[model samples]
Target chain A: MEIASFLIVFFMVRYIRTSLQTAVRFPEWERILVIVQYAASGLLAADVFLDSSITKWLWHLLLLGMVGAAYLLKDFRPVRNVWLAVGPYILVSLFKDIAKLIDSDFYESISTVVEIAEIFTLVWLIATWVSTQRQQKALEKERLKRLQEEEQSRIIAGQNVMLEQLVAERTAELTRQKEELEQTLTELKATQDQLIQREKMASLGELTAGIAHEIQNPLNFVNNFSEVSVELIEELKEERRREDRDIELEEELLTDLTQNLQKITHHGKRADSIVKGMLQHSRTSTPQREPTDLNNLADEYLRLAYHGLRASDKSFNATLIMDFDEHLGKVSVVPQDMGRVLLNLFTNAFYATEQKRKTGLAGYQPTVQVSTKRLSDEQIEIRVRDNGCGIPKTVLTKIYQPFFTTKPTGQGTGLGLSLSYDIVTKGHGGELTVETEEGEFTEFIIQLPT
Target chain B: MKVLVVDDETDVQILFEQRFRREIRAGELIFAFAHSGEKALAYLNEHPSEYVLILSDINMPGMSGLELLRLIKTTYPAPPPVVMMITAYGDSESHDQAMQLGADAFLTKPLDFNNLKEKLKSAL
Candidate 1:
């Protein structure tokens, strides 16, 4: 429809050339080309109406070529010259047609001009319609292709987002699985530790029972011998009191009596004490819990523990500083269990400092400091500190874990600290914490609720 | 009073028997012995509460002393004999569990005879 309107306007300007040019003021060459295109169209119309195959075909071809040339030509002057050349050819044809009959020629001329104009209008309309259809088809195809491309890209981008989300979900699931596995491993480790502790107890119980049994015999002999010596001493006393004593005999008997009594008592008491201590050590008695004074308990173990270490290593001259808070009150605890915990701490401190000395770490003298304080009305805090090669930060977490140890295998069952931790935390509902700096010092702090 | 000493180790039985030899002669103490929980149960079934005290080790191969104590406390409620649970480990859990199971006292290995004597004298 738009093309037909444009063609109609173009024909209007061509037919009323002089007046339209005067109104629109177009360039002279442009007006001349418009006039020649109109004339060629008119000639093709006349030929079509007259049924002149050669002229109509040739004229149609010529019109198309002229339109193509208009677009192709670089300069308007060449087109203007060609139209000016064709103007003279038309006049010559008009003049050469004088031999024709006047009456028939007049009708032919009128009819031919009218028919040509009608034919030109109709043919131009068909051409305009066909070109417009082709353009519309091309535009529609382009629009469909653009829409298809857009939809394809949308699907691809959606798939990419889905893939990324799936990957994230899978990663989160894997992380959750890993966490569960870690928790299970930790629980299994705890169970293993308990079993190991039970095993240690069994062995120690058996060993202690055997030792106590063996030592009881010697203790009985000492006690019996001591009783005989006391009886002999009484006999000597009775003789001395009843008779006038011979000086040499009396002196010798007195000396024998005193010396033998001393020997008997010395061996007797020594054996008795050893048997007693061994008996205490061998008994697999269950813990008896009571409200216990933590400070006093700490002081007691501080002496025994230090002395025990000293007995084992006479060269261990580490100074043990006891800083006990006398005002600290009682904690609900199993005294024996608490004693063992304290023993473990002091021994560990002593051994750690001793190790430092053995390694000649920084050439510093070893020291184990035990301190206790009343943290609050409800809590008591005890710290066992040693100037030793501190555990590495990496190993600190596992220090209280059973079977994790840096000491030589013989030196550690790896259950000392672990058992102590369990005793403090699980047994007494307390807390045990360690603070350490590698190559400097380590401190085990215990907090018990009063 | 007759006392049953249950332990896996022969040395334990010997020590117990020896320690109470004078009392046994005076008719003040009597002794029955079992090396394991099964044997101890068999003896108890035949002679119920003939012994007043049950002393057993906690870490036995089968039917630990705690288990035996539990059984005796639950099944033999009438004149249920006093039970002293003995363990070398001395963890809180065993102590608490034993007490909850109606044990008279809990004793750790390396037993102080005086302490045991006091506990037994009180319980018996």
Candidate 2:
């Protein structure tokens, strides 16, 4: 019986130690249960060797305590296996011990039944533990799969946001570029307009220059012949006085010839002035500035331009109004160039009023007003205004552009205002601007630096 | 004194002759006419040292008055005839160029005969 108890104690210790290490169940309780089992086995061995009922009772109590502890803490999943395996063994042993204590006759049969039940309980506990381990491994694999899927979705979301931002940026850049292109197009159009105007003016200038050159030679001959005739008349008069052969009729005839010669000289000078005006208009010579009386210059051109138009159209007439600033003295300017500018403005003003008169509007009086005033110590202003068929608003801005004209095809070259603009602004460092309203009035303002 | 007038215009000869008719009648002055610079040069070659004054126009079809003036000033014999240049253009550039080419006087066209007569009287 001593050897048997030692063998049972040795096997129990080895089984509890192995289960505590290898099984995925009952870690804390298994440690406590191992202590209790060793105590019980020691007590049982001591009882069998010394024939002590106290030691036997102690062993049974320890086994009962272990079973009760396992039952009480059975909700702990790892401890559940310990409770399931040990609870049946403890109950069966208690029953067999109690049966032996109460009635010795049925103890052997009861021991046999308890042993079979304990074996069956141990097998069921092991199978339950194996299935629980397999289920836990599957749960761990499912959690890992879910984590990987979450990471993939997060990366995709980030990429989607980045792509959206890139698209938005590209759209903004395209819009900015479109605005820049529109601005450049507007600037190019303005430049092209300017270039076309310059080209037209250049060609017109060339044509007029050729015409002026051809007219000069014949005009010079007219002036020279008239002058020489006047001189010859004087010589003939001197001869008559020296010879004392002045018969009253011959003297009268000679006097009449002199008057006729004077008349010729006068008309010849008039034609010469017209030819010179044309030449000055056509020539692109460098400006020669000199101190000139602005009042005299303006008044002279006003009359010249008026008579010139009258010569062309005898029916056309307009009242000329002059308000010259007597206080404004000589201003340094290229007289020929400034004269051209004034002549052009005066002609346009007369033409406008004449056209208004030709409309035969009753109670309508055509008037052209030329006024000059000293604006400051360093500047002068000249304004030419006409109460006539004024400039239309549609063509106001384009008036200074060469080849822009309101007159019929052959009547106007369209370069008068453009040339005047160049003369005032470019040649003299002055400003030329126009103010006009349709069918009412037009005014050209010239501001020249002294 | 003999005066040579060189010009391309034929009418210039008639005008000069009419203006100086009294002087020509009195035998105080004589006139010679050449239609071009080349003709004037040929005349001078034949009648060397005969002309007291030579009046030439600056602009001509061939051998401009300035070129003729240059040749006359440099190649003529000592006591050369006084050469005067005239032009329709009165610009300072032409005046300066003619003066620099050794022209005795520069005059502009629609000539003042009184001034020319005075200059000629003083020169003689």
Candidate 3:
């Protein structure tokens, strides 16, 4: 019984410590039961050495009180287990006492039955407590697993949002770079066109100069021979007058000869003018200002440029619209330079309209219009407008810059417009401006102060 | 008086003959012709004393008229034929160059025959 008491005390103390460590509330009734059980155990231990029946009886009474206290605290897990374990033992003790009092022969069998019942109850209590503890542990493990999965999913969701943001930012950057690349490509194309135009103009100028030089010798021969023929005819006429034979026939022959000579003079002068024009076109000359008729100058250059284009491309044709202000009268300008300016503008106008015609667009009629208006007594305005493939807005600002041309290689010397601009603005103290809409029409306006 | 006309164009011979027909028939003036500057130089070498005047075209395929004038002024015998340089290019630069190279007269073409006749008579 002493050893049993020690073992029970040890188990009870360990259980209380475990409950306290686990932060489980210790009930008031349970505390009292524990103190009573300790006192009972002490009493029982003293009786074992002293051999005192009173001490034993006191221990039995304390044990009965402990059982009653356990019953009152039965809602607590540890107390319920203790009450189940101790109740059977206490009942058995009471039964033993009754049997002794009755003086029955069944006392020993009853005690054996009581002992079996106690052992069974103790086993059941231990099993119930252990099962409850294992169930609680499993629930805690499940909750922790669920919390961890939630935390991992939250992290993954944050990463997904960051990845999407990065993708959007990269896409925006790519679009910006593509725009920049396109802008650069356009500029490069314009520069390449300018360079090709410059090369073509340089070669054409050289070729035209050579042709002018070669033509001069023959032109001189024609003019000189015609003049000498007239003189020889005059000498022959003088001799015939002195001889006085076949006078009527001689006069008829002389009249025929003089008419033929006049024809030769007229054609020779025309050839001279053409050769001079070619030479002037090939060479850059100092500006010489004189009173020039704006109407005649515009008319002359418009026809000249049209003929020049026709000489190059036989299939090209356009209806020229000329609206000259006859009242504009004479303006003080360098006629040669102004003529060049008009020629360039007219040529560009014709070229634009011709290009539009080549696209095979039905009902497209190429037309270039040249108009002059006297804005005031001091200012004259000249406009060359075309219903053609207009200048694109992107390239409009660069047209006056040297070497900027829309024409293909070998067709233009981008210097035409640039030189014209220089002649009008810098050389003549005038203004040159342009108006255009892409794919619709283009107009160049020159305003000169008379 | 004998005059030498040096030119590449063969038609120039006809023009001169027609213009001065009376003078040639009256034995007042004689004319000779050479096709190029080199040929003119060869002619001068052969008949150094026969010619009184040299009218040479400035531009020629070989041995330009200017170079021929330089040779005639420096290497020819004393009293070399009066050298005249003519060109279709009437630019001041050619005129200046011809005068600098000892040409007696620099003429531009479509030659004014009346003025040329006066100049030729005055020189004679």
Candidate 4:
């Protein structure tokens, strides 16, 4: 029974040594525990195999050495961890040996229970350490993921801020550019107006030459007529002198000659008046800018303009309406310039009516209404409204542009309205604007300072 | 030939008379006068083709010289008497139109009688 008990203890130590060796090499203490456990198992197994008294005693010494090693290693040293792995095997071996020395079955059972309890404790410690390592690795992975997410969010926010700033900066730049573009457009318009004025002056020079020739043609008539009168006077004087004896006959002849001379003078003076009106129409450059009643100016030009239209197209008859504001005070403007403006307006009105008549517009009774009003303390407004064929909406924008005209090539110079616009806006420091619809009516508004 | 002289200014008549005194004595021309466009047209209508040439102003109150020229060119196409367009400002637009409308010659004033004579000789 003693030998059997020794063999069982030897086999248990051998199995514990194998279990320790199979455990992964972890902490340095655990490696040392595994090595000591291996040596202890070998010594116990040899004692059981030899079955000699000296071997038994040596096993007893070996067990004593193991217990001493356990106490020395137990002071929290690396060997203490090593012993913990081999501790169960060494204890089992010592308990069996002591049980053999005592030769008692009851003590052997208690030693066996203590050895099993120690082995179970070693396995529980190893499992606790492995699970702790796995949990630490998992925690590190979670921290890394959280840090990456924070960094990604920061990067996205930074990009959005930069984009917002970029858009704001671009909008500011665009606003400045738009303002500059508008300024440039206004400057271009002013320059264009000056150019038109220069061109109109050049055309006026041309008209001056035309008027000079026109003046000379009538002058030629006056010369020829007076010369004929002189010849007739000489002939009458000679007849009176040659037939001095026939007094009654000479007197009758003299009376007839005097009557013919008076007739000639009458027709000559009538011709002269017509030429003078033409001269006045053409020579209008020397403007007299003064505080003049625009209403009176409109009325005067309206008559001349209507006469001109009647002369040009004898068949056309259009009504001229004057709605001059009597209460409106005088405006500081060139009266002659304003007169020309009115003339141009009336002429355009008459021409439109003529066109409408030719086109067979039903009941197209042309009406031109000249109206005025005081808009404010500093400004007065004059409106020239025409019920003749209205300006087409598409062409309204180009009406004030120089050299833009609706009339045929020979009929109109296309500078009339452009000149009027310049005179009103630049010369008088006023405003000229128009309102019109395609088949309705056209109205030109001129505003000048009071 | 009985020629009509139409003019508004008395000074222009005096100058013309002083210039053409020698011609009158030689019976080279006869003259009657009307200054305005209406008078000139009336005279021309009364004595159509009687005058050798019509010296017409472009701008006149009763009727423009252009209107008179158009009337003359259209009414009397075959035996149309010569017309010499004269202006101080000889604009290309007016000059070209006048020539196209069968004006014999275009003359710009102050009147050069020497050029006038040459143009008249050519037309006659």
TM-score quality measure for candidate 4: 0.40
- TM-score of model 2 (first chain only): 0.43
TM-score of each: 0.39, 0.37, 0.41, 0.40
Where is the poorest 10-residue window by lDDT in model 2 chain A? A206-215
Best by TM-score: 3
lDDT by candidate, in order shown = 0.65, 0.71, 0.72, 0.63
Pairs that clash in candidate 2:
A26-A78
In Å, residue A444's CA in model 2 sits off its true spot by: 2.9
Q: The CA-based lDDT of model 4 is what? A: 0.63
For each candidate, report its DockQ versus the true two-chain complex: 0.01, 0.04, 0.11, 0.07
Candidate 2 lDDT, tens digit per residue, B14-118? 567656767886887899999888899999989999997999987654466887898899988878899999876566777898999889999987688889999
Write one digit per residue (lDDT tens) for candidate 1, span A1-450: 122223433543343343234335556656566766566556645654766535533443454455445436554322333333223322332332332324656756576564565455556555654665576579768878888988988998999999999999999999999999999999988977566556445334433433343344345444544544555466567767875765665575566556556655665665465445334433456757787777766765665555445434434556567787888767788776676677777777877887788885554767788888987888889999988878888888898887777878656667778878988998888999999998789999999887
lDDT of 3: 0.72
Specify the poorest-scoring 10-residue window by lDDT in model 4 chain A: A1-10
Better of 2 and 3 by lDDT: 3
Clashing pairs in 3: none
Which candidate has the top score in lDDT? 3
lDDT string, candidate 4, B1-124, tens digits? 4445554444445444434544655677665566766688788878777886777765443455666788888976467777777654456777887898888777776566767656555665
